[model samples]
Target: MSTTDDFDAEAWRAELEGYRDRKDEFFANERQSPIPADQRDAFDGLTYFDPDPAYRVEADVTPVESDETVVMETTVDTEQEYERVVELGFDVNGETATLVGYTGVGEDRDSLFVPFRDKTTGQQTYGAGRYMEFEVEGDVTEAETVTLDFNLAYHPFCAYNDAFACPLPPEENWLDVAVEAGERLPEV
Candidate 1:
């Protein structure tokens, strides 16, 4: 993980701007997006908090050893199975927090699925939670470390429409402090 001294806030902001542009395009294009065709006319853009570098943290990541397949509850009544692969311990504000990173089966088994909630839920951000994905390769071991950038946290597709089924963050991933970065309360 990159230390604070090595973290480039300006570059991160540029990357985030690029992400926002792509997301805006995706939302505007009803043919390939979750936004209903009828509502495309009114779609402005996703709401987001100002880019704050303080929310980017370097976490001590440790891999979990278990044959466990957790039954993750989704937006709808249906539930899905996810493998809890790693635990990331970090600091937000003045408090310490830990979030679990999971992985899907088959093709996505190597991908990192980081879903979480903060004190901002339902008020300042998505009612359910936010998600972050790290396109990591190889298995996590004792020496693994990760960057937990809350500035990249995003709402699930379900936030845009009801037709989608998004997996909700487990109770363990909830943080007590307000994470004042990343995507804000999305207007649907």
Candidate 2:
């Protein structure tokens, strides 16, 4: 939930680049990688938009009065249930926007899960959506605000291989602006 106002741009960019490098190494070497085993030999790395501080945004967290159980459709013919927990309000390219954060139904997690689709979907990014999660320090209900770093947004495993089924971003989470940050199409 760190703010980017006083962030060291060089350090942030370096850290992000290091993360990307590690991820590439995992994809190319790990057996658990999302890239199909048959395609692992040719796997290079995931494409990414250059890291930009502008994509790191601060969001106002508004807890939901009644936590609603929502069934989200997946890339395949399956559904998963999640509890709608909070609304995250932020700005993107001068446009104010909101996205809902959720958690697995009947599960207590240390982080809030946010899946979303922006104008970059089906073009520059994954068609289904990308995901970002931030660790909650204490009770999420008591949180006033959190940071939504699009620079850390990433495609689900399904994006790399169809064998994996990932939840689609709810319609309410579809963004109108193009978020030109984070991982793009897989090179598998």
Q: Best-fitting candidate, measured by lDDT?
A: 2
Residue pairs in steric clash, candidate 2? none
Score candidate 2 by lDDT. 0.89
Residue pairs clashing, model 1: none
Per-residue C-alpha lDDT of model 2 across residues 1-188, encoded as one tens digit per residue: 24656888899899999999999999998999998888999987888988988898889989887766888999998999998889999987889999999999887756888999999999889889999987888888788888788999999999988899899999999999999999987544
Candidate number achieving the greatest TM-score relative to the actual structure = 2
How well does candidate 1 match the true structure in TM-score terms? 0.92
How accurate locally, in lDDT, is each candidate?
0.84, 0.89
| Native-to-model Cα distance after best TM-score fit, residue 50 in candidate 1, in Å | 0.4
> Local error of candidate 1 at 102, Å?
0.2
lDDT of 1 by residue, 74-100 (tens): 999889888888889988898989998
Off by over 4 Å in 1: 1-4, 186-188
The alpha-carbon root-mean-square deviation between model 1 and the true structure, to one decimal in Å, is 2.1
